[model samples]
Target: MVPKVPIDLPGTRYHKARVAADALRQQLTQIIEERRIALRNGRASAEQDLLSFLLSNGSDEEERGLTDDEIKDNIILLLYAGHDTSSSTLTSLFKFLAENPHCYDQVLREQLKVASSKEEGELLEWKDLQRMKYTWRVVQETLRLLPPAQGGFRKAIKDFTYSGFTIPKGWKAYWTVNATHFNSKYFINPKKFDPSRFEGAGPAPYTFVPFGGGLRICPGNEFARVEILVFLHNVLKNFRWNLVDPDEKIIIDPMPLPLKGLPIKLIPHSK
Candidate 1:
């Protein structure tokens, strides 16, 4: 989803937003300072009552800056994403590599072509990432097949019609993404994790949005992609991993989460 278009803010809306922003700046500054002090002095400064002022009204504007509650909320939301969402994607990748051992060889081949034997070359960077076209393709395919948000709920404020069904105002709509992915009308074999499905495949104009569609889509979709690619490429390169879990137990039915929270063990790989 792109940045929302500018709209006239109601008086209440603007006031509430400003209020939230101010509070966030103070909260973030407190946390950052608390961590810094803890690092240097081995504890937080009890002389400062940061949390107390936070509940009331705290503004350290000239020094630290205005509170961006929007930014603060986003940062907290990202914690769950960075951990839970990533864990799900990695678990899927490990499961695939475990079942199909040959995929590891394929990944290794791709890495060898992209890196130098030098120590510095092994360290990944944003620019270095461009070389791994195959890795990107596979991750894209994986996300398409098993999006972290398998589905979502949306409520209609006004009446709307989708397909033959009419959703009146004040009704909840549950949008299904995983169902869309399995449509054979699009993919020849929708169930398979074949990276070739996306090879040179420019996005077709339609609603296959795994992240979501319309307002309130996940903001960290691209960030998650980069994170997964870097994590997968490095981990798979440095160590070999195997899944001791069986396929039938994977339970892909409930959201993007694995049924059993996949348990895999990794062993170091020799170059």
Candidate 2:
């Protein structure tokens, strides 16, 4: 059985977590310092990446800029949020595709159609991204099943009643994506993996929120979509792989990850 103690409790796990966190903080500080130097040398542009954007001059004199520590904090947030979510989504997606070969073939066919339209050695552009309909549907289905951000928190702006409970002002509100994803009212056979659910207008506005919704919707949603699709296009076009341990289970220590780290055997595609 797993230990049921809180993370803050003094224990080996807590010590390890603290050490890992400090190491990560150090690394991020180093990266922030390097970017500051690059900016000083004019080797990097303000519009380049998230780091550059944060380090850029404010739009107007009234706009205050971020401190070096603040910039590092934002970098840590993105590195923590953006990296794991996409990586986990991709891992789960590939696992699903490998298990469902028919879906894999369908996705492969659609991707190949997109590939044929592009010139040799040319990179995918906005048009290519728009054409990846089926693949995106598959991605949606995967996200619904195993959202990287299982849920998030929001602070109540004022006193309100929800589901008959009077929530006082200053209380925190939480929403779980699973509530909708697993509900029969919102999904037909919620347990089944049906990409068709996303074929048309898809689930109602807030009902299928793998990436939260409304004002707090993930700012990087489009970036994540482009990143995942581009990755799929490249990998599926050049290689195929089989799971080394088909029976491996997914666990959520904090983020969803295959218990065995998703070991696989790669097979290169013939030209």
Candidate 3:
């Protein structure tokens, strides 16, 4: 059965959503404006220049590339999912690394090897992403333990049988990544966070979907991966990190938000 809203009004819902979205847009625009002013005189990198030029100075065809509504929706969607998911995932990854010294040591060693093998002497390149397989495994394990989009709801289009239970048509199903991930039947050593589980035998595409599956899978997963790895690479290279408290509890929510903010201490890497 679909969960019924206590107070439902179709008109009121859109109106409320619009008002909230508008307020958020205003706040974000203000923050962007502030950053623009701050970086106005600072040495702008090529990437920054490219981003500013592309968003601000549009060509004639580019202007028509996306409608005002499309642009607004995409930008808003990016802000909503892109910011928090990546941050929360990164935080979880950090916490995992801090708690598991073997994992940390392995990552550090791999990063150092990567650093040494950079022939281009560039910070990060598209090709370098392919070489970070172990790092990718680490991320996969992190998602298994702390998936950013923790839970979601789906409505059955027709009657379905799941686990021998008949789900009636139009029933709303509440599902969670955490609930399925730690199942012993689905994973080996379900409680242990081991990146190697993904090495030879990868999870079924849809079974371990952090970014959903099929066509609805996040379009930005590749983009997200690159960004995450880039940020992690720099942080790992420049800093020696340790958790303030190793035994702290990890609390998961529907949003995959941490109950306790990951407090890590980073000292400059002194060799």
What digit string (tens of lDDT, one per residue) describes model 3 on residues 1-271? 7855545455776567777898977775674455445546564432564234433443223644444344455668878788888888898899888888898888878887788887655777887778888888999999888888876778888999999999999988877786668877778788899998898878755668788765567787888898889888878877877888776777665355545576789978795
Comparing 1 with 3 on TM-score, the higher-scoring candidate is: 3
Clashing pairs in 2: none
Estimate the TM-score for candidate 3. 0.73
lDDT of predicted model 1: 0.67
Residue-by-residue lDDT tens digits, candidate 1, 91-145: 7777776776666678777876665642765577777677778777776676777
C-alpha root-mean-square deviation, candidate 1: 10.3
* TM-score against native, each model: 0.67, 0.88, 0.73
Clash pairs for candidate 3: none
Q: What's the best-to-worst order under TM-score?
A: 2, 3, 1
Q: Pick the candidate with the highest lDDT.
A: 2
C-alpha positional error of residue 99 in candidate 2 after TM-score superposition, expressed in Å = 1.0
lDDT, each prediction: 0.67, 0.87, 0.75
Model 1 residue 84 CA deviation in Å: 1.1
Name the weakest run of 10 consecutive residues (lDDT summed) in model 3: 51-60
